[model samples]
Target: MSGLPPFAAPMPLDAAAPAALETTRKAPTSAWYALAVLIIATVLGSIDKVILTLLTEPIRQTLSLTDTQIGLLQGAGIVLFTGIATLPLGWLSDRYDRRVVLAACVVLWSAATAMRGTAMDYGVLFVASVGLGVGEAGLTPITNSMIPDLFPRAQRVLANAVFALSAIFGSALGALLGGTIVHLTDDLRPWLPVSMQQLEAWRLTFFVLAAAGIPVVLLVLSIRRTPRVGVPAAKPGAPAAVATGATTLRAHLREHWRTFAGLVIGVGLTSVGLSSLGTWLPIVTARTYGITPVQMGQGMGLAFLCGTVAGGLLGVGAMRYLQPRMGPAAALRLIMLCNFTAALLSTLLLFTRSANHNFMLLGLLVVPLIGSAVLLPNVLQDAAPAHLRARTIAMLTMASLPFGVVGPLVVGMLSDALKSVPNGLAVAIVATTLVGGALGAMVLRATEGPFVRLMRAAQPT
Candidate 1:
């Protein structure tokens, strides 16, 4: 506890750090425009993930699938591949035009999502999900890597808050609009070819969401490319390896493993609660109230909308109130504070039988659960060398898989295991939240020294 496990500290990642651009300097017109596009695209990607959550019950009924199978499709089947895919994709983002990379991924995932409608059974659906996962894998790392280069450090929390908020809005839309689409598509089943008249509503919903991504792909294609600010412009004769940090990637990670470990593992643990809740909340709602999926969508969509706003304000407010006064280290501590509360509130969500009470607790859980999403990436961008930004973010993305992949899968297994219990899935969810929160806090506390050291190294001389 006195210090992090031995790892070299070196000058924190960006050795030839670009001059930090001031927000007041030059027109930030293009940066904001590009950010808007990124937000829209990410929303589409988020919808792709949450749509499964919205339709889990119907899919289970249609396919006669068990809760565990549904959970596997939503959790590990998607995120495990996402975790595996990020490494190569991160490398491409580091070396290529990220806008092009992003656009390509958007098209790939959109196509995969549309293909999901054609699945005849669980195996095909799972394979389609794996494709969706791979496509989405390219998004976060590329976007987070690009953000710091576009906005000044002073404004990064706000930028990240906006980014995080868009994901929330997208998930909310998935619930609100996805449910509505499912309801409306019931009429279209009649017009289907005789063989397909029995096609499920969820399949049509997937098609509608897939169509939404097409416009986003066009939007991404139009964004102007920006320079990679993490890497200094190469000297005229310098090798490409030097320009991209490939030669030093291993050495940098070797010495700075503690910094990366603390940030990645700590933040990743907190994601378990978020992942579990996202997958199970709809099922929980239906069981408790007997509400239709459309009604469930309305309640959840509005709650998520409120939670997004609250999360954004907390993330930005923490930076405004803390960073200027106490520095980036303090801002990092603010995330730890949120993590602690999330652990407490998430457990409470399972204790209540009242639908209203559970929803209120969920809103509270999200405030802190999402605060980490807005803050941790800023910390990663600050800690990693510019040339290695995408890979580092990708590393963080992969870290979340342990918990993100397991949380829902375990909840479903637990639900089935304890079916006779009054609220088995709810219990499993709360138990997972408690464990993830506690472990995250411990890592956050343990890694504080490493984080401070890294922040000090990143400071302007």
Candidate 2:
């Protein structure tokens, strides 16, 4: 707030002038440091979310949970609550300091994660999952809102990519770490306090992971506040007006509902494939290949790493090739391609006979999946008015909630239904991906022109 730059007034789309595609201003060292911290934070959040996936079999066996219950825990329990909390949290991010908001979120989710360790039944675990969902909901909107302010327009894609890559790393790290913890629980038990020594390996794993959030909270608080770029300055002696901003955003959405509808629904459909893959791939592989949890974790972890590296390179290359020709619409084009590619690759699972080969294919499939993740935030940030940025992101989350929630649950039900058939889980995954990809592609194709116009309209004259 101290280095307060002059804020720009909002102009109607028809009256706005086209601005240059790039800026000469370089982001400061502090911005890069902040990004580094953000990377760590993202990684921590992802680990918390993904650890459940790796531990699913053990948890199901321990709690006497059915596949449907596991699906609800993975899909609806977390995704549903997260969607419920996103709008209010997004409003808070817009109205208050993001660092404080994000820090509080970390604490809440970390505590919820710790609570998972103490669950003795499906009901208790479901409650913990709800808490975890609500806490983690703030992360996407707050982080997306912050990145635009932290770096100039030209550098945003790279910054967003870096942040997105952290998630991939976290997934990998979670697999490696979670698997190692589960594998070594027996040896680790002797070092624990007497009371904790009797706890299950999965429970102890949660406790250890929950403690990791403390440092992340401190790091979040350390981030310096950055000015909200493109926001109009409040009148000299008046409080910033939230009602006006909300009204303006609602009007904008109403006027361009088709574009937003396509974007929200398309992204949601795309998430179905990814969500199902993440939730069931490890468990299915373990069951089909007769591998230990640690082996599955290690293989999956390596796949995540390989995919992250490959995806980052591919994303960068695609952006460079496409942005010059199509500008903001390039992102949508890339995302559509990613969806189709992921769907096609998912079918290959039916043919896979070995664990290593299946994981290797999964790594390749991650390439486009990473591309979509990296660009989606940039798309929302670029298109939404600065004052409504967080809310717009939250809207996407809220709208897409059903897809994320239903995808895994449906896969679980399908797997259960096909239990008598060979490679039934693989068949279920393939079905989900095919439907999601085809529908997502059609919706996104309709959105491309509108998205481009909206991006241009949102730019400063």
Candidate 3:
């Protein structure tokens, strides 16, 4: 309360760096407008990514896919491909006009979403998932790099929270929209032209969702270009340096390996649980309680909204209370606690007796799950230099890949192994969540000292 909130200030520039680097701020109106556009894109992208989660049952039945195959589609198919694309996209964001890169990403993912509607088999569907992953990969790095430049130090936390909440809100909106489309597909079918009506409800849902990207693309193009605030502009007519950005990035990584290691691995482990929860919670709820997808969608959507809002409030309160005492380390401690809480709540999902009970637990479960969404970016933006922000974020994403690939797949395999047991899928989800959360907590605990030290060193005098 007395000092700057954690991650509210930019990192100090390297001492060896040139003194000519000038920091420029965007106009408040332009900055807010860009954030609004980013929120829309984040929401639309999330809808496209997660609509498949809601349709898992129908897609499985149609394709004659096992739970394991569905797991691959949800996990490795999208996440592995995303991991492959993230670094290159991150590099591009650092070197080029991020607005153009972002606009192109919207188009690619939107097209990929439409392609999913035409999938006749798992192979085609898998390819579409890959496309979706590649397109969506640009979002994180670009936004992470861009947000700091848009707002000044005092407003950074507010801007970061708003951006993070957009993702949660987008996910909730996705579930609602997915549910509504599934519910209305039959009613809307009759109005379609003859050739179009033959597509299944799930197929048509993708087509409709993909159309939303058009406006998002236009919005991305409209964002005014902002200077990379901490980056030094080369003097006019100076010879271009031969050293690549990657070389400087590698040196920075070598210098700060401990902080990055803890962040990447700890967060990666936590993602395993979150990924499993996102992939299987809907399917498990439907199977356990015999609820329809429409019902599942509405319940889950409401749960996501209520839970994220509650979590956001709780997180802000906790940060305000803790930062004054513990400083920047408060964010890390909050994240660890959230993971533990999520693990405990996830285990309780196995015991819920009714659809409403299960949905209520899902809401409670998300309360803890939303912590990383806000805090992780806060930590990263504070730790990395402006020139290296996107790549630094991309490295975090890449580190999470192995864990993300394993999370859903392990749950599916476990579910298959436990198929004869009552609540087999729930049991699988519980096991993964407990392990991921416990390990993630321990890893993050180790990182606390390193992170605090890094933040102290980076603080502007």
Candidate 4:
């Protein structure tokens, strides 16, 4: 409840006057430490979400579930509440101590993830999936909102890039580590009790992943609170305001409707393609090649790690190079092109009969996949006002869930129609990517003027 030290005094949310800003020689070691811990927490959350993808076949076979059901569990079932809840949760984050909101979410999701290990049927698993979504709803908004405060404006792109990498790492680790644990569980099955033996390796994998969250929660709690940067400092014992007006939200949207709507829908479309592919690629490769889940996990995990890293670094470089010659707007166009290219290449997976070729395409896909993910947020965050950052991001999160809900489910349904899961998923991914990328590009082009104006307003004279 105590106020930050004098040096850490909060500035008004609307402050644009240079005098109101804090001048620091550099962000303190504590800030960097906080960044490290946040990344670790994100990694844990991603593992919980991604392990489900690894276990799809196992869960489907065990529960007598269909691909549509698995997609629902992965997509809409999890995100329905996640999208709805984020508005309120995001408001809480903007108004309260983000550390508290973040810690609570970590504990909640971890518990929910652990519950997945105990699910007996469709109903139980559905509830657990819902719980997982509710818990995860708070993460992206809180984390992205905090990054700008933790680092300066100039460094936010780099910082956001670092944060985005955690998802990649977590996905990789979930496959690598989750697959390893599942393999181990198979070995240990003989020595286990009857109750445990009845449970599958997939179930035990969830348990292990859930247990991993404990340390992450401890890590979240261990981080000392830092003042929310660029906002007015509250009195030591006073509560921060929780309300933002509908009028304010409407007016902001009205002024920059193009940027707001375009980015949200554009990014949302992009998410459909990305999420569907991420959720289904492992299953596709496994089903197609008759490979073990463990091998697929290892292959995909290493590929993601290597590909995302290369993509991200190259993205930063591309931005710098293009911004100078083509201007920021044109540079953004280049980033979108890269995304479209990745999506276009993603279709090639279906044509290749060889696992090696598919894996190579997956790796190649990562370059543009990670590139677009990192830069798009940079553009969005730069355009949004400080006071509305969390809510704005939450809005995007809410909007994106529809894609999350439909993307995977549609792929599953399409696969069912085609009588081939692998081919159907590939067709679905390519279709979504092309549609999403084209729409995103159209909106970006239409809204460039509004986006530029907002970016200018965010700058100090």
Candidate 5:
């Protein structure tokens, strides 16, 4: 514990001196600022996602869209941009001011979210989604990288739990608000300055969400900079290469294999279920069960909030408690298993016959979605090295993008085939829960203790 191994005293990763990292500084017993930024950032991501999810049916009905089309608009389109945009942005954060990058990302994503409501055709919507995706991708690396620096060893689990809580709350806010906002905006258009177009309802929804991002972005602007931890000892004369601009696509790929691979299979599959439920469920209910958007969003959103928040709390708390008693791998593995089972419940919930039964199912399903949030971030952070952290997040993000497509596309296909949104959702959710969950679990299995150990060993100690 003598001030960052001999090598960590910050040489130069780029022209920027990098944030003057307090590697040697005692970790804060409490990391409220870090926690606050994460929650704010998660809110930004969640709002956009909720916008996409809630608007799916309205947009589809307005556009005369096919089921597959809805899937593309929500799932595949947004993720594609996110996957591509993250690597460079992530690397840049490693080199420059993360707060700056985060602020920019907020603006970009919010604008994109606002624009989405105005989209007239598939092309415009797709473009907007890509922008939104890329914007959303900006957070994971910087946020994850910041936590270790802020909390150190004693409070890692606590810090992570805080983040998980944000993820759950953010999603709930989006879902809970989406329906209400749409109702309000649609009704109030005549009094507002702008003309309400056919898609005006969704457009208004985006504007409101985008407008809310300002305070957080300003806060990001005001926050003091936190630096990356530790310097590379680097081999002999090879000289450490600090990531400046985005690393080459190939170099990024070389640095991230397992994380990306897991991301692809795991996130992709998760998207299959998540996208279906989050984006399409409202539409499915409205189209099939003859429910209103407000009713559907409120019900499902509440279940998600309850389940995810509970799951996240339990997941983080369990890891915190279990890590010492069991081991890191087992602790994490158990959390993941809980997540897998929760996803199964979410799937089952969507298909239940009785409304009460469906709600019960949804509540059960929230457990895993929430559990995964708690564990996945920590697991990925553990897998990657400081230098590769951003790149790793970006890669895994990219891998997850396709599943966004898969989930929606499958649902769309099923809808077209079955001629019913309910039937389509039932099939889509079930397939993704089983297929995606299995793949995610498979990826989790690959995380075996040693890989994580080496990754941790590589952290600035």
Candidate 6:
């Protein structure tokens, strides 16, 4: 905030601009550091987000809540709060310190998550879930905006890939650890404040889960913030708006309207598929295959783990192999095309009649996991200018919050709506995912030319 620099006109295009066509950069050791912190924060951020989703079954029984009520809990409370909170937090990220915003977010969400255990009634718990959304929503924008600044334009794909794949990381960690937290909390009945004799272990799980976030907050506090890029070295001729007005949210939005709109649509749709699948996959595997949650966790968790790791590798490694041989646009276009196809197939396999079918389809899903993993973050960084990174991410967060917005509860609605076939929820998952994949993929294609030029303009003097 203190080191104010004057702005310059958008520089003329040159060979350096075309080089940005292949936005690959030399490797940085700092990237691994960024990835490690991003991964851990992502893991907890996800657990906090989906912890309620995982607890839906047990919470339903304890509160004597109907499926409709549960839907509101997941969809309305979680999504609405996130949508509202992201704006201010994102604005803060762009103007203030990103690490501070991220650290505060982890702390805030974690505390809210812990409070969820103490809810006496539906309204209290619902508000707490909203608080969780507010906190979690702040996360994506702050962190994402930081990635491009940390590495060169060339490395943004892999860097973004590591950042984006945090979804799979979040799901696997939430499901895998949510089970363990519930199982371990079984013995602590007396240590709790009330006789949770009738209450479910999942309540305790939420408390323990929130407690795990403290260290992540500490880790986030350690990272350094980057200065705004694209602002040129000052000539000190006539001065411009170097005071607060230059950094206001209104100014930023007006300047970056196109990028913001694209982000809204892109992140929103992508989130619907992500949230619905993540919030309910364990249940899907459970009812569809008649497998226990533990077994479902193991199988699905492994698939996510493989897809996540492979996606990370593809983010960094694939560009090096492809961009020169095939050209930047060709490399990205091919990946996006294939990734969309993979998403379509994954949806088909996911909704079909057989467990063998779902599993086999999921096997194929890993390949496209690379798509969501690699492309999303890369594209976002490409689209945004340096100062607007966090806020834009916040806007994306707001847009995407709608994905989970009505996502989880829709599953509950389907279950009760068609009483006999409880797992009929698969219909919604298939529908939303296909819709989201298509919309988000198209936006990616539309933005490529703009980003290629931006990247070329970014090479250091």
Give the clashing residue pairs of candidate 5, or none: 53-279, 67-412, 68-412, 117-203, 346-365
**Model 3 Cα RMSD, 1 decimal:** 4.4
Q: Give the better candidate number (1 or 4) by lDDT.
A: 1
Model 4 gets an lDDT of: 0.74
Q: lDDT (0-100) at residue 372 of candidate 2?
A: 76
Instruction: Please give the range of 10 consecutive residues that has the lowest summed lDDT in model 4.
Output: 1-10
Select the stronger candidate by TM-score from 1 and 4.
Answer: 4
What residue pairs are clashing in model 1? Answer: 13-385, 230-386
C-alpha RMSD values across all candidates: 4.9, 4.3, 4.4, 4.2, 5.8, 6.3
**TM-score for every candidate vs. truth?**
0.89, 0.92, 0.92, 0.90, 0.82, 0.76
Over 1-461, each residue of candidate 1 has an lDDT whose tens digit, in order, gives 11111111111234443444242333277888888998888888888887777777777777788888877987878988899899889988877778888998998898889888888889989998999999999987888777876766566657777787787788888778877888888877887678766777888878877888778888998987666643555444332233432435676677778877887787678667657777786787777667776877777787788887888777777777888787757766888888878777777765677766666766777787576567766676666666777787787677667877887788888888988998887887888777887888789888888778777776544
Cα lDDT tens digits for candidate 5, 1-461: 01112111112233233333433334442356656867887876886787676677677777677777776766667756677787888777766667788899998888888778678788888888888888888888778767765665445656777787777777777778878988998788778875454445767788888887788798888765554544334444343345445335466455545545644665566556666666555565566666666776687778777887677767767776776776656545764577567566665644467555565566676776676667777666665555556666766765666676677677667767876444756766576666766677777677555444544444444
RMSD of candidate 1 to the truth, in angstroms, is 4.9
lDDT of 2 by residue, 342-446 (tens): 887888888888999888987988888887777777677766766777888898789888998999999989988998988888899889978988888888998
Measured with C-alpha atoms, the lDDT of residue 413 in candidate 4 is: 78
Give the Cα lDDT of each candidate.
0.75, 0.81, 0.82, 0.74, 0.66, 0.63
How many steric clashes between backbone atoms does each model show? Answer: 2, 0, 0, 3, 5, 6
CA deviation > 4 Å runs, candidate 1: 1-23, 187-197, 230-247, 324-326
- Error of model 1, residue 264, in angstroms: 2.5
Please list the residue runs of candidate 4 whose C-alpha ends up more than 4 Å from where it truly belongs after superposition.
Answer: 1-24, 189-194, 241-247, 420-422
Q: Which ten residues in a row have the lowest lDDT in candidate 1?
A: 2-11
Q: Residue 156 deviation, candidate 3, in Å?
A: 1.1
Colliding pairs, model 6: 23-154, 24-154, 25-154, 71-409, 158-315, 402-405
Q: Single out the weakest 10-residue window by summed lDDT for candidate 3.
A: 1-10
- TM-score: model 4 vs. ground truth: 0.90
Please report how far candidate 4 places residue 410 from its true position, in Å: 1.5
